[model samples]
Structure formats: structure tokens, C-alpha cells
Target: MTVIDSATENVAHTESEGGIISWVRPKRVDVDLVIPVYNEEEELDDSVRLLASYLLGRTNEFGAPVADGTRAAFTWNIVIADNASTDFTWAIAAKLCEDFPGFIRAIHLDEKGRGRALKTAWGQSQARVVAYMDVDLSTSLANLDDLILPLLGNQADLAIGSRLLPQSRIRRSIKREFISRSYNLLLRTYCQARFHDAQCGFKALRLETARKLLPLIQDDAWFFDTELLLLAQYQGLRLREIPVRWVEDAGSTVDIFDTAVKDLQGMARTRRTLNSLSSEGTGEKENARAKTGANATAKAGAGASANPAPALLPDFRGALIPRKLSYTV
Candidate 1:
């Protein structure tokens, strides 16, 4: 397989004990797939290696065939986002980076939230497209092409794997299936979301679109995926969903009841905020109309610009400047 030496060389590597590594903007990459993990010491190494191999092995679907000794049509980077794993996960991550020089890198976060891990990785990525999947191989690797192809092909701003799609093949308990369907039904009734699945771990986004929506998302736990999709739909971002083959991972750490409660709360809060913004926008338009009589042109412009909406989230890489972050291996 053609190695991504150029992109790998641009990254900083661990040199000595207690050494500090500063984040630098590296050469642009075509795709950066982030695997977020927490205390996954047993599974991290194998999963990452498998994923790296898969990404490197892919050939261009169309165009001239990729011959041996030539770089593939796309260059990819695998980012291991470790969210405060209390085990040897960090050490394993560091070793993987060392073993697969240009193919892999790992990030350590002080917090222990899945959303937090994703936020750090996605925000720091310099790749054209950013994506994340569960460390467990519950979803077949075969479906990966479908999940990322739309984003790479520029057919959609975001792509999500949907186990709820009619064509999806799933192997899971009846209890889990019912919970998933009921949760999605709640999302549709409360938030009016269009997508079939919201909580699927397999998802991708154009870097630009991710930068816009990441800050607005407030949930830093299991509710994160749902909140993200809801805001993206509310703001009118294009989203595409593909059927995926998924199997239940018995080792899943999710607490169904707790997660369900949190998800419901997150949905309610998001709907309230969106309604408030809509109201403010309407009020501005009405005032502008009252002030101007026959000057329809001026009124329209004033109404649109007046009472600018608040920033989606506090100060999360708020500016649209170049994406850069402190790098440590």
C-alpha cells in the first residue's frame, strides 16, 4: 500500500520523557477518521490496526486502477481519541502511533465524555472530511465505504449510517431494537428531525460543516449525537443516510435508562432554544416592516441583519480561521 509519508512527517512525534509538543497545522489530508475510546485497552490496538489497513487498501472506485507502488486516490489518517481512559489505553495509543508512523496518531483528553473526545479531534483535524466510529467492530467494516463516500464525493455535507433504514441488516436483541425505534420516534415527534437514525456511532461530516455545528452542540455525553443531528437539521444542513449492517456488541458500556433520560432532556432544551431564535427573528422582521411603508427592499435587508442570533456555543473554536491544535504523541 502507498504510505502517507507526507502527512505523517508534518506531525510531531514523542521524542523524550517530559517533552512538550506544540500543535502545528500539518499538510491537508483527504480524510481523518477518529476512533473515540474510553478504557478500551483490550480492543484498541487490533481495531486501529484493522481500520488503518482498510483505509490504506482502498482503491479508486472509478478512474484508472491504482497500481502497486502508487498512492491511492485519497490519503487518510487515523486519529485515536482517548478520553481519560484509566487503563493502559494511553500507552497503547502512543505505541500505535510509533509503530505506524505516517498512518496513525493519538490524542489524550482530561475529560471522559464521548462528545468531548469527538469535539477535540474533529476541531483539531486539518482534513477535508472528519468522521468517527465506535472502537468495537459492531458495525461491519464493509459499510464504511458507504458512510464516507458521499462526503468525499461532495454529494453531501454530512453522512450517517442508519440501522433503522429498511435495507439495514441488524443483529440485536428485541429490547434494544424497541428502545432504538422508540427513541427515534420521540426525536421525530419532538424535534421534527428527518434522518432515520441519530445515535449511530458511524457518521461523517465535511470539516466546514462540522466546525459550524460543533460549537452549538452542548451535550458532552451519550446525547451528543442526537443534539448534533437536531441542530444540523434545524440550521438546514444537507444530511445523507445509508443503510448499514450492525451487530450488537455485548460489551457496550451504555446505561440505557440514564442515557434515555439525558437524551429526552437534551431534545427538550434544543427545541426551546430553536423556538426562541425563531421568535426573535420573526419579531425583528415585524418591527422592520412596521418602520418602513413602501420601501420593501430596505425593510427586508434591515430585518435580516437586525438582532443577530447568538453564537451556537460559548467559545468553541468560534472563529472561522484555520484549524490548528497543540499536538502530542
Candidate 2:
């Protein structure tokens, strides 16, 4: 991972006297919100202002709460991941950083791509909880409460907003809906991932877990989310999919056909990795001579002769599936 010393890394880590490491340490203040931007001049300013205002309200403008039993106020840093935008996006982002001081910051990357920008910004952040949402705010800032709730409640290591769940209300075209379903189905069949919606752009991860898994992911585009989730699953990290209300924004950069093909390719790669791991485990057992040759041969024969039926994949059973949201051109 490329480590750049940006304003976000100014937050220092604290150590305890007894030497018990605290993984929930907030580097700058509290939460680090990373938004990767690529030619989002139309929506960038509004989204950042909205997020800043909401965060300020939540922490009482970084002041002590006036009421009894209220939690202490904390800081939130907004990291704008500039993916080499050929627009006024970076200028506006820089202005926000200057205006907000320690509260907002911008990191400019000449390399273009959503995944590349996100990975750069995430690595530079020091918050206990690191999060990224789409530039258009299609998922809305209101749903952020649901995404962070699991992390705050200590029930999950990662949380993602799902537009396919029962409580979710997605607004999109039928063609997009059909393509999304087909992509997810292929992912489950080939990669054995339990996540129902792998393409959702709004996702949060515990800082420690993200630090460990982000490097394992190589994709720097739409496939980035899927690769991260797959690596997280392999490492046994807990994940929660919260229902969300997603409005399809016009002028989206997603090319449905191209993205679908890329997603399928990612799933195939994940499947190969899993198969390799399984084979390695079997090889290790064989080298140990844990069983007699005849027994091993018999077991191998049985495994080979056993039905080659594919493993049962997880069902999208936790919640009721919602209808696709219709969009007007």
C-alpha cells in the first residue's frame, strides 16, 4: 500500500500503561469519512456540505453536551479522494479543507479511478471507523446511522448498505435491476460469498480489519468492493448488510455491460483463490501422513466418486427482497 502523509494522519495513536492495545483508537477524532470523487463537480459540494452539517449536529459542533448522560462530542474528518478529475472538483475540495481546517481535508491523486482513489484515502485516514460513500450520495447520508450502528454496538466488523433488502427502496431502471441480479447471482455461484449486495458503494469497516485486508485487494474500480468483501469473508470477519433507500441519480458513470463483465471476472478470480487455498490445506494434511496410504486412497476415491454437486450457496433469506425503483429519463 502507498502510504502518503496527508492531513488525516496528523492524529496520533495512544498507548495504555498496561500494554493492552486498543484497536478502536480514533486517530484524528472519531470517524473518518472518505468520499472518492471523479468529475463529480455537480454533486460534490452539496454532498460534502450535507455530510459536514450532519456530523456537526451529531457531535454538537465539537462541544460538550449540555444534557445529562449525553455522550462526549467527537471530531469527524472528511477526506476527499480526488481521482485526477479534470474539473473544478479539486479546487472546491481544497477550499472546503481550508475552510473547515481540521474537520475536512483533500488528497489529490493523479492516477484516475474510483478504487484507486478510495484505497489512497483510506490508507491515509486514522479514524477508528473508516467509511466511503458514492460521490452522488445515492444512498443518502440518513442511512449512515444504520451503517455505523453495528460497529458502535460491537455486533459486526464491517457494515454495508444494501439496496436489495426488504427495507431498502431502490430507484432504477429494469435493465439495471436485471443486470444487478444476474451479477450477484454469478458472484454467489462462483465465489461462495454470502453477501446479497456486493456492488453497493457505501461501506464501512473497522480500522484494524480494513488495514489488514485492503492490501490483499488488487482491483481499483467497481470490483474493489467485491474483492474486499471476499477477502474479509476468507479472514472470517463479521459483516452486516443494512437496508437502504437508494435513488438512482442521472449522469451516473456506470456502464452496465462493462461493469457486469468485470464483476464476473472478479468472481472467477476469487473462486480460483479459494480453490487454491483448499488444495494447499489438503496437501499439508497429506504431507503430515495423518492417515495410512490405503485409508487416504480410499478417502480420496470416496471424495472423487462423491457427487460433484456444487456447494449450497447462502440464500438471500435474512430479509424480504424489494422491487427495483423506477427512474424517469
Candidate 3:
């Protein structure tokens, strides 16, 4: 064991199937970002490298957020969740764990479902917050700070990226665009959901909240994101939607129409499930929140510049003092 003078500075390592594991061996992290994949060999390496390096650039060698922890916000790592990829995705992910050591890890599942992969990743994670995004990195990374800061400041219980928002910038084929808008429209129309977009892969939530909700989630596929968010809304939890800059992946493998049909079925099932929960009084849902997408934007943390949010970054791996956060609501 590699030992340090104190527990706060201590670190450990163990050789495992995935590689030298260390980060969580001591305790939990501030945030965990999982990239769930299925047969993504071609995009696996580059995407992981880009994402991990981008994350690393935010922190210094002392495991503290850069420049007095303002920009760093949280100590974080990435997990590559492989959903029975029939290719070299797992192998590549394992190598990344080795390359990044404590900052990146991998998990393999025999089943193939984005929801299953996420449920497993988020369920097992010890981070204060757990989040996921597509391997393609469809959403711009700038929006990530906006996504995470709110959850940390208690400004939101969950945060999601939305391409349908008026402020969003997007580029894609007409068919995909139409399908995307139509799906969210149904979510607003029939489901009575207030959030603008439901299916964006980029999402984050406090692990505390995730623990309560993951077990209740039923769908284990593409519809999982939508279902999970709907349940959060049913519980009347705070949700933040950030307008994102997204560019379509031309060689995407998803079968849009087939997924859409399945999603319609899932939506129907979810509508029923939500109604049941509300009737049973299990959700504590707000009539205003469920009926319309008009939840007020949370106020920003007072007396601080907006750039480094909340004014104070918490002590690393230590206690976090909650503060009310304000930003684009």
C-alpha cells in the first residue's frame, strides 16, 4: 500500500482485472461521469482520451480543484460502462483505466441496455453525484460546468442537457430533428412533464437522489433516460435544463425509427406508472410542476462572480457545505 502522512492525503492501489485501481479504494469521489457504450470500438479511444484529459486539465497534481478549487468544483473520474460490446470496446476501456489510473475506470455487463449500464454504473458509484453522456460527445463541454454546478449548490436535484430549448444550437438532419422535437412534445403534451427535453444523454444527479430513484426505474434501454427523469419530476424534485450546443454524429449507429417506436410504448407505460404513483401519493408531485414546464429558475449564489460558481469550492474528499446557487434558471 502506498501510504501518506494522513488519511486526507492518503492513496492506495490494487492490481485488478481492469488494472491498477485506487480512487474509490479509499472512499468516494465528488462526481462520477459514466460513458455507456455498445460496440463503440472506433470511437472509444479518442472519446475517452479527450474527455479524461479535459477533466484532468481542470485539476492540479494535489488532487485539488485548479486555482483555489473555484474552477475544479469537484474531484471527479470517468467510468466506461460496456454493455456487452461485441468488439474491442472493453479492451480499450481497460487500457484507459491503466492509462489514467485513479481518474478512469471500466465495467463490463453481459446485457445490452443503456439504462442497465447506467443503473449499474450509478448504483455502484460512491461519488456525491453521478452523471452520464454519449460517447460521441454530442453536447459541447462548456455546458458541463452549468450542468454540474447546480447539483452541487443544491440549486437543482438533477440537471440535463436540452437541444430543444430556444437558446440551444444544433445541427442535424431533418428527420432526426423532427423525431426529437416530436418525442419531447409528446412528453410535454401527454405526460404533463415540465422539463423541456427528456432524452438528452448528458445528465447528472446527486448520488443521494439517484439511490432513491434508480431502484424505482423500470426501463433498461433507451427509454431509461426519459423514464428516470419523469420519475424525478413525479417526486417533485428540482431539475435544471441547460441549452446545449450539439452537432449530429453522421455515422451514428442508433436505429432512430425503431427506437422511436419503442419509446412510444415506453412513454405510454411511463404515463401510467406516473399516474399510479401520483394517485398513491408516493411522489409528492406538485400540480404546477407536473402540469406545466414553468418551474422558476433557481437564484444564483449571492455575492460571488458567476464565473467560479457558488463562490466557494468544497474541501476535497471532505465535508461539503451546502449553499444556495443562482444562475441561468
Number of the predicted model whose TM-score against the real structure is largest: 1
- Using lDDT as the measure, what is the rank order of every candidate, best first? 3, 1, 2
For model 1, name the residue pairs that clash: 23-326, 23-327
Query: What's the true lDDT of residue 83 in model 1?
Result: 87
> Please, what are the lDDT tens digits per residue for candidate 3 over residues 196-238?
7888889999988999999998999999999887777666677
**TM-score of every prediction relative to native:** 0.80, 0.75, 0.76
- Cα deviation at 291, candidate 1, in Å, is 2.3
Q: Candidate 3: where are CA atoms >4 Å away?
A: 1-25, 58-71, 282-328
Q: Poorest 10 consecutive residues of model 2 by lDDT?
A: 320-329
The regions of model 2 sitting more than 4 angstroms off are 1-27, 58-74, 289-329
Task: Write down the lDDT of every candidate, Cα atoms only.
Answer: 0.74, 0.69, 0.75
Ranking by TM-score: 1, 3, 2
| Model 1 per-residue lDDT tens digits across residues 1-329 | 11223355644444432221222224677888889999999899977877665556533322223455233346778888888889999889877876777678677777889998899889888899999899987777777777777788888888888999889999998989999999998776666666788898998999999999999989888888998887777666678888888999887878898989998998778877776666676578678667876666866777657855433331222311111111111
